[model samples]
Target: MFKHLLPRLRERSIAAKRPVSLADMMEEFWREPFASLAPVFRDGGYPAVDVSETEGVVTVRAELPGLEPADVSISVENDALILRGEKKFEGEEKKDDYHRIERAYGSFSRLIPLPGKVKEAEAKARFDKGVLTVTLPRDAAEAARNIPIEGA
Candidate 1:
């Protein structure tokens, strides 16, 4: 009995050293192939977005790494704020020996819808240390509008 159990324990130990079984790999392969190829945004590959509203001003913050100030473009159209940029990779690599690669390199765009109309001339943006912060102040006349509702 003891000898039989020893063989079984050794088999289990050997199985643990192996990478993965074929059945497991096939199950994962069929599950979601694009899951591994998904784009990584800031904040663990999820787009970093934050919005704050003051008495009359709204602030938006986004994190964009590996980008220069000139590489980023911000535009407001139809009350939607668009942030677009490209994170480029310009490193020399040997064709024969590339062990691993995990960093993301490509263009990314983030669209943020403003809660209220903003003054385009008064909007401000600053990028520092991979973080971009945008401040949009609302127009005073537009901010003061209070639509009265008639009872239906």
Candidate 2:
């Protein structure tokens, strides 16, 4: 159904272009807000992330391909987890045989807020197989404060 409708839509667009009025141009402009935002999406940035919590600990995993351990930094401050990294495209700088290029480069930072205070000293991070994982242990006292209240 959509395949047959597409040609009619294109024909209508062509006919509509004949005497483009101010209202028609305004309608076209309002219809596509992302056309001017293509450059922002093209910039390689912000690696994907996944976070999980178990018991008193939270584990965060991020996918960072083509990045080394030294290129990444993790920090926690005021219950906020911060992950920052820079991905550099490293290959021979030759002027030949380049088909397509679609990878993000430069620095990206992701900050995740924890629900409660965590044990900073027990936090650990490891990177393996292009995946970075951080383990955060919650503070024992804060983790045990949620006692169920009985009906009065």
State TM-scores per candidate: 0.67, 0.65
TM-score, cand. 1: 0.67
Off by over 4 Å in 2: 1-45, 97-100, 144-152
Model 1 over residues 28-63: C-alpha lDDT tens digits?
568766555554425243247798889888898888
> Which 10 consecutive residues of model 2 have the lowest summed lDDT?
18-27
lDDT of 1: 0.77
What is the lDDT of every predicted structure here? 0.77, 0.78
Q: What does candidate 2 score on TM?
A: 0.65
- Whole-model lDDT, model 2: 0.78
Report backbone clashes per prediction: 1, 1
Q: Which parts of model 1 are misplaced by more than 4 Å?
A: 1-26, 29-46, 144-152
Best by TM-score: 1
